[model samples]
Target: MRTKFFIFIFTGIIFAGGLLLCSNIKTKEIQFEPRQEFSNEIKISKTFKVKPGYKLIVESDIADVSILSHQNDEVDVNFYASGSSKYLKDLKVDFEEGEGTLTIKVKRKREFKFFNFLSEWGIEKAELKILTPQNINAEVKTAGGDAHCEGLKGEISISCAGGDIKLKNHTGSARLSSAGGDIIANDINGELEAKSAGGDIIVRKLSGSIVAKSSGGDVKVELINAMGESEISTAGGDVIISAPSNLNAYVDLNATGGDIEIDFPLKLEKKNHDKLKGWIGDVKTGTKIKASSSGGDIEFRIRKGEI
Candidate 1:
């Protein structure tokens, strides 16, 4: 009988220990729940009417801005605000329309609260999307997010302090600058000026003059047609150029601490391991293509079928 009693006591102790372990696990799970959850989000949108040939300006401090061209004559603007309840309430969007210009600005009201240190209050996010006619001039500025544009026939200018800038199928002149991100352009048909202080630059299918410079990243350009002067430089990365074999251009390549590679045939006016000055075809009719790198290699090559 005593042995049976001890056995029952042992079983009871085991069951109680298991239950206590499960209770502690549940408490830990509850403690971790707050850290895993993000604050609630709210979305807002607005549209504005804009005519062709009108100037469109977008200014935002922390949103990714995207501008796309359409055949429609009116412009549509969409804004998305995502954050805590207080953050959503503090967000504001303003629009102004003039005779020949439309402006959209995103602003956030300042607030000070002691409970803001709580982890439940997440970081805010703002996003803007603009659709305009195919012929409108655009100027977009963002302080902390990416900017993307496509299919516009007018001049497009973008400035970003902390995100990338991408331009595609732009037929008119374009000027872009990014202080903290990359710049990419494709299928551009006009004068191009692109600069980045902290990222790479990539250009493809360019048909006109291009001036691209990167203070801290690489540059890669593929010329579809050598129509005008091209200048590409990088302070801390490589420079690569691909052009047609029959391209008539005066080429100058310089690599300070790296190699210069030329895979195409050129009438060498001057040649060295780190620099080359030459012409691809007729010297007088040829355009000028200059590429320089301070800390990386420079390469010039002819496309496969072009040779």
Candidate 2:
């Protein structure tokens, strides 16, 4: 009996030691160190003269882009490039100009077979800042970086594969999408459509029609002025809407696995715990707002006077 007890104690000690070693390994794997140095850095600046209503197009593989409106009729392009020594040596920016359009593209001199794997470690980054006329139409595309634009009176389209998108204080229509990042738009005056496959979407002070959808994140919108219709949905997140106190619109809210909460008084056309169909004020305007969530709650409220 004593030998059996000794054997059991030894086995227990060995098992505990193995578990402790694994815990240490996991902690080390999650620990991160800040990067304090880069092997290469490059800056390029160019200016292009164009008409007032010219079109600006930009494409990049791994760069964050910022496009803004300026008073001048010329577009100023500035590129700030930095990465490892090998990546910096191969980076290139190409520019082309047509009758009423300007195009800028960033490319690499030689393709690295393992660039996709290395990029996950954040070994390189390039950022572009473009300033154009206030009324120029803009289109921007990036494979792995954020995109931002503001103060343009023409239509704008932006897409990013692995980063956020932001549009602010613009009078033109906008269509934006991201594969794995959030989207935010504020003070927009025209039609807006935004979608995210794996992140949240928030829009405030909107004056036109809006359609926002997300597959794995929340959807929220605050209407400053309702000119048309609005529809927002999410598959795995909450939906929240805020409107003015005296707004006249029909609202329909639904949640599949959660509650529907409305913090304002409504004239009920239909009512239930998980679904609500009502009008904020008179339904004479025929304006409609719909919000739905598949696996989360829905909240519709009246905006405070501060909004």
Candidate 3:
């Protein structure tokens, strides 16, 4: 009993230490950003000298974030706020600039334990927008607001707790997720990993391998010319995948509470009411295509007018 009690005490001490380390124990010099884009919005904007190979990281506590590509070599950070500037006093903007990395963290100051609950009761609404060169890698995170990353030609990752996520025109591997909101991925040319905890996922014009999933909503994927090994699944909603009719692929689809539908002339290997295993073309030279659902239908079809 004594040993177990001591172990539990030690574990709790470590956990509490981690929590304190995450917030309220700060000691660093930082910077805040943006410039006004409209009359009713207060903005502070700044530009940083950066190279093409530098890594960019951003964390927005409760603000929506938009990342876009710029023509110049430097990076631009713009922050906009609505309502009184007095609440700005409770915001912390931290910047860490090194020779190879630039990290920007923006969040409300959590001075004490009750600071967040009290501050968010009537605080200013804000947003963060970033403009950087097209060749830099980036990781963006948001607490509960939407995140959009566009025209990035390098590895990009984004996550949101409870807002929508959009990735457009990216040329490198991308990772995207949302806790309770939808995801839209368009015009991507690389491998992708996208998921949603409780919302739908829609993908279009993808040219590489993909793994897209939804825990409690629908999933739809529309691909471009040349494909790769792909997996699309959902836990509680429908799944629809459309591709070129002549692509080389081995298809496998399953559904628990609904039917599985297909349009391609597949070489049927196995078929039943709740599952299907087949080949779209020569599987030896093709990729694997898999789709599943727990409580909805699964449809594998060719793109409209591609018949």
Candidate 4:
């Protein structure tokens, strides 16, 4: 028994010493095949016949989206893509059609291969264009691209995850949002809501009410004939608002780290370097105009040659 016990202890010590020595041994570094990229071009086209109350919903993984309207009561869609899928297969689309509703959803299933030398990795850029019936409600979104919509009537919402959003000749209730880019609207009416995460919000020739906010960029709004109780705020950029000379608005402006300036006649209630509350034309029957900035100036101006 003593002899057997001695042998077992000796074997255990030898095995531990071998493991300790093996821990210090040099090993080859892992190498991946020099960042190879694979890309493809894809084109998709679809058309749908619609009724009186139709709705269009489109979603893209990474694409530039554009929407336009036509006279006929049909919705046409076209998508063109030419780029890599960034280390995976191309995006898969699911189309769903229901009673007065059409949906196009794009999705990508991620896959990771360990010890893969031929993995594909690159950006995927795409363009989506849609021609729709007039006065159709629509909801459009992109994961990482720009968006442009023109002449779309009815309630509409457009968004981009990492690019700019532009609206031209849009009417009715509209909402625009961007995660990391600007929001620009021109020749719009009705109601609008614009938001940005890291870029400016610029609206021109707007004949409606607006609610705009930005996290890290400027806010500029130019109004036309009439406006609703509008509110514009920013976290770290300037705010510039312009309206017609005879417009009636109850103005309330504030800036935490900058100045406030208004180039209009007013029954000034309160005035300071960073705060102002007054009325532009009629105090009793005016829309509320509120703007605030935390780190930049706030300026209000009358329309050119109208004051």
Candidate 5:
């Protein structure tokens, strides 16, 4: 029994010494030739003579993209990736061209950390920049960056997981959705739809129909003309509407727990608890309007001569 015990202890010590020696051995550095970091700028300029009724789709993570209109008939694209050389080089961005569909995407890699202590040190990745053409239908999706587009005449759709969205001077139908940031749109001439989970929404110069819903912020809309209908709803902030003098549309305001105020061309009579039923002027047959909130105030202003 003593001999067996001695052997077991000796084996354990030998194994531990081997492990210690192996741990102390230096690991080969993953050498990157040139060692220089990658550029933060990615610029792309391309022109496409595409016919009408086409679509462009862009998908990215950690990038900000913008699209604008131009007088030329050709399409243009520009992009810049902001990251380390290894990270950027590892990304594979490719595009597919179709008769009416253009798809752009980035390939991502898996990164692993071996030590828990190293994992505790926060590391922030950089984003990219993308600029696309104008006058074309577009759909953009980003995971962790902001997106802005302006002066587009075709239909537009944008989805951001955790960044702000800004749109201006859009003449066609548009849909904007964000999961973690604010949404702002201005000078929109066509239909508009927007939703946010944790930020405010501001819209101005709306000409057609609009629908905005938020769960955690305010909603403000300034309407220049209402060709069809409009609706705005929120769960945690106020709702404000500013309509033009020529606005001749139906207005519906509802707030479950906030005050309802309406300023119209004609006088309004208090109908019920936090509710009012009145029209400033003759509304069109297809006009539909609604402003609702669950925990904030509601205000509607109708400019003079809006009848």
Candidate 6:
């Protein structure tokens, strides 16, 4: 069901701007047209004093997007477009008054060309900036672009198709997913569930439960202090973690094709399998630490006297 939903979203994005897809352009037939306008910057600023109970949904195919929270209850959006004018005309920003949600989208025409056509269309990048309240339940989707968020206090869901994903200084339940892009997050204060398909994943300074998985990238996790359970997995990269010295929990480490190294104050009682067990110092630590890898080595290290 989830996969179906993702498929629908992807389809909607491909058809977003109401533009038709072009057939393959032969490289020999491609010509640089000086008459075709190629660059533009469009900015939009709007404010919404939303009521206490409502959800905000934002969708885009933007080159890049950043969403941050502020002290007030209003939202301001600034969007820029740099591309073929024929394509930019289809992009639109939608919003409503009263208690309705906000949806932002960019519609671009897909261009296909034969071999050597890549030389004609140079690199084009656009950036969109969004600012909203600190407490908002929102979902963001971007294709061929980066998505970033910070200082959020409610549920956040972000997905990217082919760019980096970043979350900074957020304090709420989050669901982050990406394909063909790196993910970097930090300063989380609630449950975090993140997945990546073909890039690196890094999370630091989390104080809540975490469920992180990656398919083709390295995974790095660092916790200054934690108060919840964690389950992290990776299939094709190294897994590294750093935890507090006075950590507490039932730790589990597994690696299919890698080495395992853990630094704890005390040794865990062996589990009789190809794994190690025991406690660092006191068995009353509050949380459990578990690290696993499939094709790399693992290391678990302790700070100092915390054992």
Candidate 6 Cα outliers beyond 4 Å, as residue runs: 1-35, 96-100, 109-123, 271-274, 303-307
lDDT of 6 by residue, 158-247 (tens): 999888899999888999999989889988888898899998889878788888889998888777766677888888988877777777
lDDT of 1 by residue, 190-272 (tens): 99999999999999888898999999999998888877788999999999898888889998899999999888788888988
- 22-120 in candidate 2: lDDT tens per residue? 999988866578666567788999998898878889898778999988888788999997767665766789999998899999776666576454653
Per-prediction TM-score to the true structure, in the order listed:
0.83, 0.84, 0.82, 0.81, 0.76, 0.78
**What is the Cα-based lDDT of residue 256 in candidate 5?**
84
Worst 10 residues of 3 by lDDT: 34-43
For model 3, residues 90-133, the per-residue Cα lDDT tens digits are: 67777889888999888877554644655443445778888999
After TM-score superposition, the amount by which residue 258's alpha carbon in candidate 3 deviates from its true location, in angstroms, is: 0.8
Ranking by TM-score: 2, 1, 3, 4, 6, 5
lDDT of 5 at 242: 83
Q: Which segments of candidate 1 are over 4 A away from where they belong?
A: 1-38, 111-121, 305-307
For candidate 5, lDDT tens digit of each residue in 2-43?
999999999999999998877766554455578465444344
Give, for candidate 6, the lowest lDDT window spanning 10 residues.
114-123
Candidate 5 runs further than 4 Å off: 1-47, 111-133, 265-270, 283-286, 303-307
Q: In model 2, what lDDT does residue 257 have?
A: 95
Q: How much lDDT does candidate 5 score? A: 0.76
Which has the better lDDT: candidate 1, or candidate 3? 1
The clash count of every prediction, one per candidate, is: 0, 0, 6, 0, 4, 19
Q: How accurate is candidate 6 locally (lDDT)?
A: 0.74
